[model samples]
Target chain A: MSRPAGKSKLVRGAQGDWEVVIGMEIHAQVTSKAKLFSGASTEFGGAPNSQVSLVDAAMPGMLPVINAHCVAQAVRTGLGLKAKVNKKSVFDRKNYFYPDLPQGYQISQYQAPVVGEGKVLVDLPDGEIEVGIERLHLEQDAGKSLHEQHPTMSLVDLNRAGVALMEIVSKPDLRSAEEAKAYVTKLRTILRYLGTSDADMEKGNLRADVNVSVRKPGAPLNTRCEIKNVNSIRFIGQAIESEARRQIAILEDGGKIEQETRLFDPAKGETRSMRTKEEAHDYRYFPDPDLLPLELDDAFIASIAASLPELPDEKKARFVKEYGLSAYDAGVLVAERETADYFEQAAKGRDAKAAANFVINELFGRLNKAGIGIERSPVAAEQVGTILALVAEGTISGKIAKDLFEIVWEEGGDPRAIVEGRGLRQVTDTGALEQVIDEIVAKNPDKTAQAKAKPAVLGWFVGQVMRATAGKANPQVVNELLKKKLGV
Target chain B: MSVDAATVRRIAHLARIAVEEGEVEKLKGELNAILGFVEQLKEVNVEGVEPMTSVTPMQLKMRADKVTDGGDAAAVLANAPQTEEGFFLVPKVVE
Candidate 1:
């Protein structure tokens, strides 16, 4: 990981420039069928309290049991992050009181999390930045307290209360919001690729708690304020920017910054103080008595490592090396798993550069306009591959290939059938092109004379020949024949 | 690790327990006695021993990932103090 030296991302304050430091604690719900400690279903959008189990609701005499699949998923995630998997980790009780938390104490990992230190490589325009992972802990999620359902009473939804969440904490290595967003995006991609978490922010499966603090250049770490539960990537960046500015304003006015928790109001584009340091809860954390320490053998870790799929970074490098693609194009194509797979299947035994160009430039551009993901693309990889083979074989001109692409996109069918049905193949025969060039040369004697004077004027005759052939003429043949007939 | 009256009051407030003024001294004494008993373990000087979280020395019980329960909303909400429209009604929690 290379950091561009001496490039300071600082906020200009009333006094001087201040550098803002950012770290994120992202909570991604693990992909599983049941809750972490209970056998209740973990489906989303269930009726209020419908998914609550006896253990989840804190009923009397209900002892919590750890879900084996959730543990395996967390271990797989830890390996994917290149983090240390602790053999002996304990579950601790984080005591607190809220309507959402029925147990009055959340079962979480405190001193001994399952995953130890790790690192994520975030790709930026300048270079790569490595964000250090502090730890990854397994914890149960709290229920939802709906305040709007009633005028004076809150409704509690326990569907998500006992769901398992993996809290991935990053070191304060990010200096800008762009780096922060990239970090989250890369992390989410890795999780999705691992099949550990879906990481859908819209469904509340993923959320970020952003920590923002500002300090002068080369100064010690200052007091940091945590912006809690920022759901979207766009809003995470906005929250960091606004929180850093708020801290800088305070420090510039000779006021000491206090460490506290704040909330980001997306509507106002500002962060307001939710709780001060004085009101901060002292969560008396102690190991839970009901559960024993998790012990994993070497075989378990090895199995998980063997089961890991090829990650984005590895796939991008392979694409660059195997297909001889540019680094930028490879990065773009390999950013999403489905897109990369699509490109690999399309580029097989065909013109790799042409396949890459079609996928990146034409297909991506149309997909963007239509607001559809590559998974829902109208054009299949096999169809695109066939079209590229046609272009490579010289059966269709590049212009004809574009028209064919449109036909295949709007009206899905075999590319060969469409090309045969529409008679869109290129006219590469010199005899056919010669007659058209002759007609154009006779019609435009003045342009022909200009072409004879300056060879650059040959483009005019080629344009006329192409127009006469309805853009189906081979452009290279048209240029050659036009120059021969016009005596350029 | 010492528990005083003021500390007991603060803890009660943090836990949202309604501790009366007359009960503060008794609660503090009771908490201090509990802590006093726990402190005796520190004198044993078990320097090389691991800190134990559970009484039983075994791995945590793992369950297969299956949704074997849930979907009975009425039975799940049967014990709620107040129910309205299949939801547990509590005091409005303002964030």
Candidate 2:
């Protein structure tokens, strides 16, 4: 596999040769029924303000009750990334004033987070890549600012306010746009597989703040620029590429890249400076007066770890070794948690290779074309299993099995029943096939002479017999009978 | 633990506050008071304690290597402060 070219350029600076150091801070929403500190539904697409609770809306007298499920999900997410699960964590008040933030300060893990020191294995075309996960911290999300609906005044919707978010931070490890995109993709996959967070970038469930810098090869790191609130994976790559190139051009033109927070304009395909980056003290982060320090036992951490499901990498490896699938196929199947589950369920008690082909090539292709998910697929696991069973039992040819799948997809009937009802079962009776071949050979003596001269032309006779049998004749048996009849 | 006036002004500016010069001293005093309370964390013996990242310990979740719907440019830019012909508009700073 080839590595993607570096987006930033090496240049001579006032401080001498410089190198780029990149890190990322990703905010992923926790998958749970309630908000971080309230019993309100965390479901998206609710009526504005309907999801907000007293705690979520920052009511003065209402106290926050931490959702245990959200915490469990955060811990599960840490374990999935192979991070250290800290038994004790603290929620601190990050003081800031914004119309979108109903609470004067955000309740976020500051000095301490629940998980630490993990690594994500990103699969690059060159080889397997490992991106260091610095920490996975939890915090409540702020509300949204609706600026367009009202021209003079901005309206705030607290629906997302107080919802739990896990800010997974990474070390300065990624080198190119492709790697950055792969890292986010892999992180989302792990989060989904753990069932901790939905990791939906579009729903505002997951977003990445990309940190990029430029320098000379193998030199000390240079001042970095952070692109904020990039919500899509493609934009993440585009931002990194354009930001790095912009920095390179600036340096090449004898200018310095400022340490600032920037925003990616996907339309313009460039990153614009937002503001100078602020340090921690700027937020006036301090322990919250309302919440107490969270304390847990070692056994509690161990229990959360024990409950984690098989992650993507582990499932991918198992798919390859157990099911005889290619590494690429395994990667595709295990990319989504639900798709992996669907494949495993479909492959049960069937030829693994055939089942994998059907799932990846036929089923996934159809789902992609129809813009549906594997979970919402019209074809069920048992239905696919039945189709495979028919092919296995020699009741239908592989070509016919595809047609059967379409029938099952559209008409919604049993696979075996459809094959039987349509009389599409393969004609395995060698005697009947021989009789047909004998008739064809006698009827077309000239063709039989030509076939004897060119034995490869026997395929024409096989096709004729298949057409004669309405494509119900087994292809292998037809070929065999044609060969024996023509004596070639 | 008293925060200096200069440090307070810098912090305020970094945080995007348009604070008046005379108000810096009062803000400094209040920040010092807050910092003094947070200093209590230094007293706890956390020598062997790992830094926590989340409230409940968990791992990162994984998603599939497939593309979701992100091609709609008009829908994405619809919420921007100012936009022109499918592009976000910002004040021109460069000549």
Candidate 1 lDDT over residue span A52-86, tens digit each: 88888888899999999999999999999999999
Q: Candidate 2 at residue A153, lDDT?
A: 52
TM-score winner: 1
DockQ-based CAPRI category assigned to the predicted complex of candidate 1? medium
lDDT of each: 0.89, 0.79
Clashing pairs in 1: none
Worst 10 residues of 2 chain B by lDDT: B61-70
Candidate 2 C-alpha lDDT tens digits along B1-95: 66798888877675668999989888888998889888977788899996555487554332222222123444434455765543334333220
TM-score of each: 0.95, 0.80
Estimate, for each residue in A258-302, the C-alpha lDDT of model 2 and write its tens digit: 778888998999988775444533577887756666666778778
lDDT of 1 by residue, B71-91 (tens): 777887888889888788998
